[model samples]
Target: MPDSPKEEVDETGGPDLISFADMPDRLEAAGLTRISKQRCRQLAEEDPAWPVPLDKALKVGRMRLFDWRVLEPYFRNRTPRQGQRTDLKPPATEA
Candidate 1:
């Protein structure tokens, strides 16, 4: 079966280098809603910060492409896992 134009192909199974300037329209047209273009640009810019907000990413530059897996969680709004709390430390592991 032929794929529809609305669906993007990532048979490469990896992230593709993408430009932030063009990412807004491509992402929008693909039906992927994001926090904002500015935030998208922040990811494009590879900022060194955790929990980057949408509006503060305007100072970014166009950069590389990323994989669907890499970006999926950002666009997909999900609920927090059950029985989880940040106040507690993760279970220690021995290797």
Candidate 2:
């Protein structure tokens, strides 16, 4: 099986794995839709809301506050992808 995340600590005391809670701010930050804490608490009750889907949305809007110190490294200075044709090419026609 694949190794556990860095945040996981085994009895052997190996390298600590990275966890969502310990992740950097940028990675933990929101993506597009922003949400409020009150809304997050509500979403937390729903499926696919609390962990990332909701958090990312709220983070993008810059609403929920977080400790970026550990989460910062996870994020990067990245720009949105260009709207280029990424579709797979169809098989070429025989001559």
Candidate 3:
């Protein structure tokens, strides 16, 4: 067992540890698709499915560190949304 549950083993028996600051790179490394830090913050703020931090008391400045085990499933099963806004479609041209 790790000194902290935040570094605990995942369900798959692999080491699971991550920080909010490193989330984008870690997600990209796992082939889960990269996202911006701003997007990460958005998810943390707006996404209900976002995993809860294992160590809520711990903080790196204002950002919270999270367990990778908890996040892996969320990102892996995330529904892909269109990159462009649906309402932003250009006006149809007359033939």
Candidate 4:
């Protein structure tokens, strides 16, 4: 029987490995932030604080793959903390 397109064999020819193209959707499905390939690449280039490190990306020919298990924590940590606001001003006191 032929495997489904979504199911990719790993180097050891074990269970299915998630593909890079499907990463964003997987992240969303897992309740993590959804980031596109372009966005991931952009962050890698521009942001030193990017959650997923470039080294984590596995290059297979022209495709780039990632492990969701490894990335999930990073995404969760990236969320802004409660009560944290960039725009805030103190109220003026009556003179």
Full candidate order by TM-score, most accurate first: 3, 4, 1, 2
Whichever of 3 and 4 has more lDDT, that candidate is 3
**Alpha-carbon lDDT, every model:** 0.50, 0.38, 0.74, 0.64
Give lDDT tens digits, candidate 4, residues 1-95.
98857633466765344565676787788777778867655656666676556676667887666665555666677753345555686766999
RMSD of 4: 6.9
Sorting all predicted structures by lDDT, with the top scorer first, yields 3, 4, 1, 2
Query: Per-residue lDDT of 1-95 in model 3, one digit per residue for the tens?
Result: 55854534766876465666788998888888998877877787787777673345246676576767778889999996757876889888999
Candidate topping lDDT? 3
The candidate maximizing TM-score is: 3
lDDT tens digits, residue span 1-95, model 2: 99966542445765333333333322434353333444334433453413344344325243443333322322333232334565776767999
- In candidate 1, how many Å is residue 80 off? 15
* Segments in model 3 whose C-alpha atoms lie over 4 Å from true places: 1-15, 53-57, 83-95
lDDT for residue 82 in candidate 4, whole number 0-100? 43
Range of the 10 consecutive residues with the lowest summed lDDT in candidate 3: 51-60
TM-score of 3: 0.63
Q: List the residue pairs that clash in candidate 4.
A: none
Clashes of each: 7, 16, 0, 0
